[model samples]
Target: MSPSSCAVLCAAVLSPCAIAQTSSSPSVPAQVAGQLPTIEIRANQDEARADLEAEQALTPGGVSLVDGESLRQRSVVTVGDMLRYVPGLWTASGSTGDSSFISSRGSNLDATNYDGNGIKYLQDGLPVSAADGNNHNRQPNPLAASHAVVARGANALTYGASTLGGAIDFTTPTARDGAPNELLLQLGSHGQRQGSVTLGKVVGSFDGLVSAETRRFEGYRLHQKQERSSLYANGGWQLGDAVHTRFFATTIDNQQQLPGPLTRQQWLDDPRQAEAAAVAGNYRYNVDTWRLANKTVWDIDADSKLTFGLSYENQQFYHPIVYAPPFFSLLIDTEQRTLGSTVRYQRRMGSHDLLVGMNLARTTVDGGNFSYVPGGAQTLSTSVANRASSLELFVMDRWQFAPNWTAVYGAQGVSTRREVRDSNLKGDFNSINPRAGLIHQLSPSNQLFANVSRVYEAPTFYELQDQTPGAPPNTLLEAMRGTVFEVGTRGKQELGSRNRWNWDVAVYHTRLRDEILSRDNPTAPGTSLSINADRTVHAGIEALVGASFALGGSSAHRIEPMVNLTLNHFRFRGDSTYGNNVLPAAPKVAVKGEVLYRHADTGFFFGPTFDLVSSRYADFSNTYRVDSYALWGLRAGWTGKDWDVFAEARNLANKNHVSQFSVRDVASANAAILSPGEPRSLYVGARLKF
Candidate 1:
């Protein structure tokens, strides 16, 4: 097992074996014929000390974790290429897929309100809807995920919801977590193809999982096409040792052929112009979702524990479009539903560790739209509805105060309510958020950290009941706010006797208030409005480093290297309209690099990657700008025993860039192009396990 001696024998067999043996493990029996798959030394050292104590208690905010074997060695598909080494994220390409306007250190993507850009989107923890909230449908699929966690600014205020630009958790994949029985296939380049299958079972005490996938693409421009299909199922049971029950279902179908956005004189005249008179659209989407959950764990005797949960969700959307002229042929339909509940209490009081929580949520939304007029009928038809509710109470504590210091205090008390039943409008808000952190352990592998936080945001429901006829219907000017501050350091070492290293660094600052700005209507001269300016400020820094080694004498031949970086800064404080601009999908700098090689007894693997982005300002009065690019990718793999095969190459430089921009003129200065991305591609796949 090479790969750096199988990562030092999987970090000395998972380094921390006794967190009450994770609920008293017992249930080991599955060493069927041709054995060879038994290694659970305390479940690999308590999952490597619970992943280094959850990365040193989330290192003062700004977290990142991408597992599933690094998304199959970086063959990441979408979700902005799996957040391209995440660091003040800002993925691009919209009009369907890979669109995320994330802000962390140097805020201001409109002064990041709606929860201080402390973003939020979750799949396993529920909640996922940013498609129209304008985060552009970020769906990064490594076959739908087995891991993803990101929590940025103000350390995401201990997850009691309310983002100031940070939060993402997607975990999907289960079946008592052993997920097996599978099939997959692939083909590459602009003609791409993919197919998948999965099935799992344990039929006795109930445990099941089923999956399906289909994909196709023939793009890189010229008639562009894309297709998708998905189906999923989940089940769970074990309702006796303190309860557990679950159910989930999913469905998604899509069709696309929208080669619609050009004009740099049609991309310098005919860059394979196919019907390039521009503005041709077609899309069909269907989504069905259902979830029911119940969880309870109360065993207050051995180290204290208590948890309670309840969940429900429903979502739907439909779209029809054409876009050209005063906006033509458009029909949109939407629906959302949510119900949630949570209660938690945790304890391990010796060096102090506590958690208390309460949460409640309610959401309902309705949609409508119809507009035609490209030589015909249906001039307009509109209907809308809205509802929202939230409640929260939180408390957190860590305190180890000595033995290398540690402290983490948190507080949250929030309440919100909104209703816009056909523009009759109603609103209410209340908040009290606070956070504090400190960490130090300058040895045992080093550490240091700091934090401070405050956040709030409200307004969605299409930014308060969007009416769209000269705008402004159920308005509340603005109410976004944020205050964050942070500092960091991290380390790990052992590089000499055959490598191993890890590093992380951070810096952040933010200040904002009221934010949100979009203008033109100085009393209607062709309408357009959204107010609440007043302040802004941002700052950034992020760094990551990694290494691994071991080649010659086995342990399965290995190598790994990684680097990630980001730096950003923003302004705009008074009399705004992008005067001190620099925040329109801000991407001041970004970098990523990776190299991997593995061969555990002929289970060959290879990886190479590089991604960089810089250059910013795509409208919002920053007067348009979009340049800077770099991309390269490759991945290869093969394994046996349970079978696996893979290959990939993406955007290996065929960069023409420009993923999002707008400014159809408040008086001409040109800028009307939406969705222009994709220029290189390849894929090849295979997988099986039983």
Candidate 2:
């Protein structure tokens, strides 16, 4: 390419919306001609970024693309910070930054702790969650990602997802996507401190990015402190003109001290006190992990493409919970390993767009259980080795059957197996999920869409390890199978120079058989005992609406208001014991949003954010209820080219309330099930990019 063409290409590549060239590109960029450093735009990165956006637009279901650039302005400590503006996905802080009790579309509707299920978590589009269908608080730190994609429920066919909550893929940046060098610092209440550094560079046909971050937080309540450190890196290579491959590496270590649940009386008296059992047992949770992955994309032809990926992970986990005399406490020493692979092919022919993919994964866990002896040594109780493997094949096609109408259809078939040695358990499962949808385009930017689909989810290790024989297959738990129907509309309307509006609303209903649920173990209050519910129903609305209005018709000054809300009605479907009882743990309603004032000329923004959650049942019997709560926060920030400064105050009212709680079959006033919310706290942060 000539110098003039190179200039144009460079401008296009550097633009915010530029797709950029693939791994194998032309000679050095135009900067080389200007006596500046050369930059190589990787092809594989371009494909990943472009495909995510394109794929999301094609799905006629609940989907969202998160803006990581905007998120950098605030204190990005947890996954909650990355998803607070997206509705339907619910999360609650679970003692630490990486641990967020999460659920979506009523998936794992009643799970009580930080370990998440139903949702298939990913980093750079490779599976991070185990194959046995448990994420278990192992989500990659969102701070390391440059952006994210969320496909809710059955809409995630492209990623070969069969779980009810669908998929969340975090995308990291290359030098072309982010600054070559960047730094972030944060300080907050409760002895909080955080720092991170990121470096990126492009050399010829190769590009690399690396980052390291660390954090420490002293709990407001006793025995709740947490410390975490993580490192992330990715490098891309151009094998040839038609093939591009990228490799990723990550390592993380987390240490957390548990402040066990409190009784109703304990909460009312002093919400900041750690549970007596927790203090006595020295309850703690710690984990160390490392992962490696590779993705290769090949351009088959002008209208066809293929992508292949492989990932491997290893982890060591230690957790000790409440004391019980004979056992004192359940001490867990576990080492886990997981390997995942995927292949996808895409093509466009006439009016039909096709996608076919395959996903395979396997996980192995060597676990040791010991009975704690207080001040003495522990005694070996039992040992087990768990292995799980899965294979999935999926295909999807969208055809424009009419001028303004399109039809979408897809099916995914999965075969899985789970085995436990020493425990002497073996189980095999198979499922076929199908999806059908239609879209009607009303205008260039307005559309109405609807979909009906099927979902299946198998039990994870958490539920399997603590089993007490209940039914056939001996002590086996049945998988959950459900049918979902949904409808929604999404679009944006520009109304003159002073106002612009955007909205996305979706309503869905699901009928499930044998939904996996958990309740507090009677003898060990709040200790989860998983069970299968015969019948259940989950219905909910996920909506988001936002508007930006220019003050006095001047673009330099504006006011923006946005709201993300989810209303859930999850309950038993005429069960013998709990007839029409609402599900426990997950709240019925959630509201989060912000209203901001911005001075574009000076790059200033100020906003007030809030969270309102409805009261939730603490027991399947509906006799125990947690109180509804509201939290308010304020944020102010200024942005300059390559720089950002921000400050925020959270839980302004300092309300002492139950932020989260474990569920039970029946509850009493003395039951220990409550986790207190954080008190009023302030945080300040700054970011510099070069």
Candidate 3:
């Protein structure tokens, strides 16, 4: 028989009637077996949503989880889109593309180096940002995640993140996620278009998944066009019942045109116009990166598990940020390489859970500044060579000392070194961070948590090289250190037979010393300074309330309302200069949420969304202020088991406002330093799975 005929024959042999006939007539069973060989299949499953939720419940500080499946109902072009509903997170996308200004608890709000610091970005529990605690504008594509986890401040101790903003982790999609072969297409305002493809399967002992995406946008503001392409793939192998291994590969190319910031007067006149300097210089922020990693898990008996990881990354980028006179536009081009490794062991004993881990990273950078002119003319002016490394060891224990209470404690020891070869400069830092927390069970579905922790962050190569005036780059100053106190409650409960409600609320206060800070030079057009502040304080409240009710007591229809609010109160203390001044950037109050109506049986939903932001300061001296703004939008979608479609409309009022901007010690009220938010836009997307 031909292969096709054999397949048909095999199906017929496995039919219910055939099975009964084969039992009555044994020769029929032998004939059916001739088509194929006997085999045993093994499939390893990834952690389920409930597993991740349980893990987060063990944390005694602020934490959140975002389901990627839920995000598929709307346009997700930026990190801001992925994290919009997460409390305490502040993300503002540029006029187009994934470029964004992100902060938490008033961290990394500096003007000079907005590429982001004070936060660690990770993918599948491994670092995606560089070794030196800098993001370098590298944000993992959200499309590849099964879900995302956000751990704010010292809550990220388990991940070896000691920065004020802590960590954001995106978990890769896996075969167990049951993601089918898919094709996706999107169309939006400003000549925007995107296409994506994903393939996933589980075959015998091997499980594999791969996804690729490409996007183009003409942007709302002049000279703000951007393009991106990315590819992500992973394969997992079930070596045995005791061992499992996975490998990952990722690459992304981002090409973004710079519209730059506008002066207060310029924004007032026309928020859509690009800065003259940017237009004339043809400035850009372009990056190309590729990475490979391997992770292995060993389940050695029921009570113990071990994890090992290694990774290699290569990146090249060209960015033009500073526009000088006829001499040159300050440009940076760099080739960076990094090697990282990690090992962790976990054990469960009676009432105690113990975890110990070690992580190491080494990085080398070779780059130089360019004397750039319009029309792509350039010259290599100054060269840079740098080496940096970090090593960390950590241990934690979760002890259930009583029936209703648990105590969590941990300590992390870190050693880091940074060297500038050309300048003959070097700096070394070491610190030990300790954290302790308690969790009290209010009920099976509700809990209260309290924690106090210490965090330390050393200056990166960028800050160490900015030797402007008062700050001494040679010494690199002291690392930023902070102590945080926090209390929070989270839970879900059934309001009645037809309604359910959920809530998450947290209050946190932090005292910081030797905080690294930076500002654009108000007097010098193309210069900036990086300094260490004497003292500062950050306090905030993060609250979220969500509820769902069956419309008219009918299970076929429902209404959902969600509200999230954030309050930031940051200020300086006992400083000779800028005494008691509010921190620059970030609003004092912000609110966001949506009200949606859904037909459960048909999988149709529509929602109205809103965002309200209070005014913010443009300078540390509080001389200039950015006005407050409110935005309204809508989302509608229809979902099916194998196909889905969505439409997203934003800035329906076409409000003229600033999304984010640079900062200074004191503003002249006319310095060109504001980034305009996008105007009115609409997006539509559809996906098909097979």
Candidate 4:
């Protein structure tokens, strides 16, 4: 629909509600009539929550929020588990560790392995992704976050993010949100064990919180093992009523064994076994990271504020693998340092709201590779030094044209530069992307919105660097760009005798140029070549629906049902080699649902869950297809005043399925592209809060 028509339709539905609210109701109590304004004033005392709510209100597209308390009640081991109910996202688990192949709205369609550059990641409103847009699954720890916000497509403009998959911000727990003291322990199948401790306190005008978690797992697949430890802490000082400053620090040490992928025949024979080559090479990855940051906010007045923050990170990486030459192994070592800063100003003027922001990030790396022969001395292969920088400036204005109507206009200008000194490669990318949107409030609980935006993304260092011997780096790759049109509606309502219902529905279409397509080497499991496609198309529908109703006429007992569905239609648009065929490894439909019985007074809950995924082509030529699969799960938990316990069972049927795979233009029968799913597993956990 045209922008003008979309606005008119939204106005027509929302205008009546505005009129009704303006008219006084006789049902209101006389004593409370004069206190309504006062209540509204006190309602916004929680500045953090209020500010986040206002930002969400201005968004005109898809968005989702995951409560940390909800996750704490279940297994929050991986991002896939954390986002089990979020729509429009497809997460393929590489269960050996926290790594996953994640795709949203077809943004990373060809990303076969652990390539997460399409999505922007943030921690407490600060950038966590590298300057070149590269991200890993382990950075955003679910246990450390109090809540998470997801903005799909162009809806992330408020954070200066312009990308196809948009952004995800994990808000860490502070003194205000964290419990005074807590301890947790978990035990599960495959010899899994985990423990965590958290402490929070407030003294005078200073508050502080600290959390630490340690975990180990003997994975379901052979040769797959992992151990990790993480610490997150934050402290705040209140200088005055209108001024606050906070400091944050985090440290992580992770090591994981790579089980790798198997061939179709091998998977059918023994899905639990790891790839022979990977086992022989003893592939593994180890990383250590430390980060420090500070943020200060100044309330200019009740109607205006300024925020600024700076962060620094240091990391050391170690990776060992055998890609093409199976008999020899390569050890990759890298030391990386990053510096970043963000500044933002927000003000309210009558019916108008304005926000201006700027972000800067720079990263430098010293990297090298070495070859290790069996029972022989290691030989130095190649060395390189690299640097990358990104800068973004954005401005947005929200105008209340009517009592229930809001119009928004915003744009972001981005400039990025990448340099590989030893490789003699350099590139600069720049873009100015604009966006416009409209939000119409149909009622206090309902909203309708639409938006059109442009997005651009540059290739990351991992994608451009050459891993093979005597091969030049990928210097000719161009930036990918696209335009997106989206519309959505979301609401909550109480109807039919205390029954509650909530829903979110969205539809979007994106037209693209220079989409990235990767080609895999025949003999290598990890080596790939990057090529840009001329044109492509991505369109889809995402919806989530939930309902709760009392049982047996008892308000204390209720049944809740939830459903999430995603339908995608992605293809190469009139390409010479692929024509209009469907893209590889992207499922057309994915559906998940759950039904649970809850006793609110007793804090008891149990649920049955199911997931169904449709098959898709394995290659761009549409010559091979993967079979579809369905799975079932169950979970039960009891949450008391100061303690909680839970148990969960996954893959109840011990089904054999393909979790993920590497995509190629055309594949032979012995491509060895299958990553097998985990077997049936059970877990139990308990937490004590004081």
Candidate 5:
């Protein structure tokens, strides 16, 4: 099959009848062939990916399962790069190794770094975000994930997540997914290189997989060098016919140089130049993490199952920044330990399906900040010692009331507690959220759905506290709560028996109270902190469609066309400071398009891709703004049973534009708030399987 054709059916092929084979005729009366040789079967029958896809198809809201195998055919390096095809998601890259600013449905639109407050992140159903609702771009490497599932809005309640941005879960490959010994290498512009070795196999009743990787990049901008090494492994064992256990472990060491944002004039003059302030203090970031986890599933009966999990993680962070003041430069050191667990039960009763789940997590941080002086004693600025805990309980039911209609109802209760010892601040937040939806099947392959839900988001430790001068910690930072109303339709269709198409579309509106926003202060030397807004409104429309058709009446030649669009409308509601002003940093319209040609004979495919972003305001005042921009790129690749090679080129037109911007109250001559987009670059990579 052609790669373009496979892309459209990546998940649709996992229907119930596709994976299971049944025998015909009566077992009691079987015709015996001439002395059939006894065949000893010793293998693990694990169908995790298919099961996951089947589960996702039941959601009555916008959801997607991205095929990691298809993404491997491109120059994918960061989490942001992998999410380009997902509509309504914005991921803007910073430096080579810096965390990308990520948002969904207008949540945390201006958060520049480490903002996962409105979104929940999970690795195999275990939370990766800390109990304090803080998350970074360090876990679940895209290279190691076999697939990714995105549950939009209240649909994530099935996974024990209660947030406005919903949840994203990354699943690893197992022996059943054709994982085997392999080697891969990638080389690109700006002195970039990446290499990895992976091993996988199944022996008797046990299956295991492991991978080790090293990556380095000189970066497109000056002073932005990055290096990282990571190790990941997982093993599974069948304890009995109805019970299975799995274990996972991972470690990563990363270091990266920081090239701060630049002024509009500076970017136009020399986009590659690093901010002078960053170079003066030798600004940099480093992280070291170790994690271990275990999960077990029991088939309680023919119609029910039980799942449980436990995990522990330890991480250390080192960050240094240069700011103007009597304090010169600040060096921050933090150590955090987290423990988490999950329990779930699923059952099927006639035409109704039910799920009940609970999630628990706790995190503790020991950290401090110090003033750095050349050849002098280090002076202590502040100390941090805090603990955070989270608990969630959820229940959901899907009822097929009629042959062509289904209704879903779900509810979740969440409780979060934060304890700060150094600053003597404490907070406890609790809430109950509910959701309801209806699904109507128009045909065997088409469906339409609508839903209403409520979400509550608590403030993270970073948002509740201040690190800059003259801005003190706000103990009054209240949690944000909101209601969501959404409607969508998604399905597959066949044309002329040989051509097919798949589509997904959704529109939603959200009203929030006590919205948290980060506003930059041009008068200050550093970035802005967070504050509570009186009220806000967020609305957006997301759409994606792809079609595969034979070219020129030839079955051997095929063409695929794809397009995705996100339209956003976000504003504040009657606030004393800003009334009904559009939120900053989020583009009003974003679009993506692709056209590809594929040949079935040699497994070859080539394509052209483009992205367009509309102009955006710089602040709540709506005085200054960034201009709209467009980017173009090309990609080509060949895949075989055991090997694959790919080459891609980005920014073919060499457009000079601002890729990302910092939100501020006002723009001035000295306060630089722009990050330049990368110049034209090329990348080539290959993978070999044994």
Candidate 6:
């Protein structure tokens, strides 16, 4: 209860819907009062959504986009449910599926391994994690994504190297100029199922699209099970009208099972006990990915334009993790390749507008791992390789000092090199980042924005192979650095004849210098080893409010409401196993709400959602607490005129929560191991267009 008192109690409960939409009243049309005064303007939404929201507000950093109709209206399955509401992201999913982990902001989790806290992974922009030292866990198949974008914390500087918790761009969908065909199916509740298909065509000068998906699950513990599949394609061509070209492709497959973690007296005696005892043996995981991209567009005259792109990628993964006894069975294999190129330029003068870019990337990673001892005896192998390269240059400008002001400036420069083979360790880095922004309109649909940026991050190969001993090894991890500060605001209004409203607010701060920690040692009782720990600080605030109404319909029913809130303030300031505590698994409040009902001309809809979390601490010596939860969900839909149907229910109640925790070394002390969450589920789906 502090974070400015929960942002002043959410701005006093939204100040009465912003003073009843600024005392609304505006709507008159009866033609001919003085006969000669006409002026009404409001047209903007083409040019591909205003050039993708002005390239997401003059992108220099801090991007967030997540669309695909909000990931099929929040049914996002994994990638930790599409980034768990973003902002300074953090995600953890345990009890198998390779015990997921993702971190940003206050970084740790073994410093984002690939080599150590210099995060990088892209799908429609190539690079798919893996470059030896083994951090292999690339499982893409969120229905083969059609939208995703995340760039925060370390300002990716135009994506040409790992950018530490900054860079995730996945897009895969194209061809629509009067669509072609589509299909989908789904079923749910622990034994879930799914299927999908899509196709589009043009030929002659290209213009194509193809898609596929498959999913299955039997999870909710007791020997878990999962499966996934995907395929994708894209194409384009024009060559005239200022020239153009494009291409893309994708593929993925996965299988999963692994249900480990229990302790604390078997979760207080029977939390479905099974932290290994040979839970039926073969717990599996497998993956494969491929991508290719090319783009070109050149006008070069009449306000200038020239753009080009090239890309390629390949990825692979197979998994396992264990602790001892006849249990030790490990095998990991990886291969990666990437080549990239980019050059972009645009210009305009008078009211100013310019952009310039240059980028290059090269990557290779071959890896190996094998172990089968502990009773199955004999088998050990290790072979690792990695090579990396990056370069970038950028400039941006936009000035229009009047008509309600606007200004934006940017600068970026980066260089990187990394090579490793066993222990030859080599790393080189360089940086220069700068950005400034401002936008103000204040009326006529309101607007105001502000920004400032400078970011950098580097280190990986499991933070430099700190240690390796048949998996579960870390020798005091290191390599992490950071700085980020932000400010934000957003607006929209018009509420009277039919109502409307919107709001967004933000505040942030992050500072770290060598922050990376993950230590856990016990050794003889129940065993332990979790490594890494150093320094930290993280701060936050985020808010959102939305509304829409028109319930008294002339048959165009509608009702909408939304709320989102988050307030975090992690701290560990210079570590000693978490000096100031709090930063272990963060979570100091998070809330979400929604109610949407619609029927605009028979395309029906219904909704209800609520989620909340608070109370956390799973180590870093905050003693061990993990309690605080609330969940509710439901949805229904139908939209005809090219088809759609849906139903969803998640965690309805049935609470037995605890999504992750660790620390076990029993025989006398140190015991805490939980990871239970997931019960009550339902999903039903359908979609099509042609």
- RMSD per candidate (Å) reads 24.6, 8.9, 12.5, 6.6, 8.7, 24.8
lDDT for each residue of candidate 2 in 1-690, tens digit (9 for 90 to 100): 222332343233234212111111111111111111112333354444554544554578899888667777777777877788878887777655457777788787654553478989887778898988778748768778878888899988878897888989898777745444889899999888999999988887888989999999888789888899999999988777778899999999999888888898999899889988788887888899999999998876555678899999999988777576753467777898999998877655545566667788999999787777655687777795989998877777666666657677877778888887766777777777779998776765677889999989888876664343345444767788999999998888998857899998999999999888876566653257777787899889999999989988579899999999999989999987789999887789999988999998899999999989999988989999999999999999999988999999989999887877777788887888888888899999999987
lDDT of 1 at 18: 17
Model 3 lDDT tens row, 496-532: 7878999999999999997878888655555467787
Model 6, runs deviating above 4 Å? 1-79, 82-222, 225-281, 284-329, 332-368, 373-379, 383-406, 410-445, 448-490, 503-546, 550-558, 561-690
Which pairs of residues clash in candidate 3, taking residues 3 or more apart in a chain or in different chains?
none
TM-score of each: 0.32, 0.91, 0.92, 0.91, 0.91, 0.31
Please give the distance, in angstroms, between residue 594's alpha carbon in candidate 2 and its true position after superposition.
0.7
Give the Cα lDDT of each candidate.
0.59, 0.78, 0.80, 0.77, 0.76, 0.59
Per-residue C-alpha lDDT of model 5 across residues 49-128, encoded as one tens digit per residue:
44454455457787877777777788878777778888878777776464666678877765355444677888888888
Off by over 4 Å in 3: 1-47, 465-473, 522-527
Query: After superposition, which runs of candidate 4 have C-alpha atoms over 4 Å from their true positions?
Result: 1-54, 178-180, 323-328, 374-377, 465-475, 523-525
- Candidate 6, residues 1-690, lDDT tens digits: the string is 222332343344333323111000011111222111111112221333333444554443345666554555435566767766565565656565433566655444431122324356666555454332123456355556666667655455445432445667665666633333678787777777877788877776678888888788777776667787777777888777667677877777677766665655666555655557326444455667677778776765555566777777677765544445453555555676767777766555444555556666777778766665433443556676878776666655555556655566655665656676765777665565666766665653445666666655545454544432353332323445455666676557878777888775666676666654433444322223333335566767766677878877443888887876767787767665456767666577777676888778887878887778787776656666667888888887877877777887877886667766653212223353566777677788777777
* TM-score ranking from best candidate downward: 3, 2, 4, 5, 1, 6
Which of 1 and 3 is the better model by lDDT? 3
- Residue-wise lDDT of candidate 1 within 429-503, one digit each (tens)? 666676888777666566778888876666554454332345455655455777778887877788677667887
Candidate 3 lDDT at 183 equals 88
Report the Cα lDDT for candidate 1. 0.59
- Candidate 1: lDDT of 421? 77
Question: Model 2 clash tally?
Answer: 5
Global local distance difference test of model 4: 0.77
Instruction: Give the top-scoring candidate (TM-score).
Output: 3
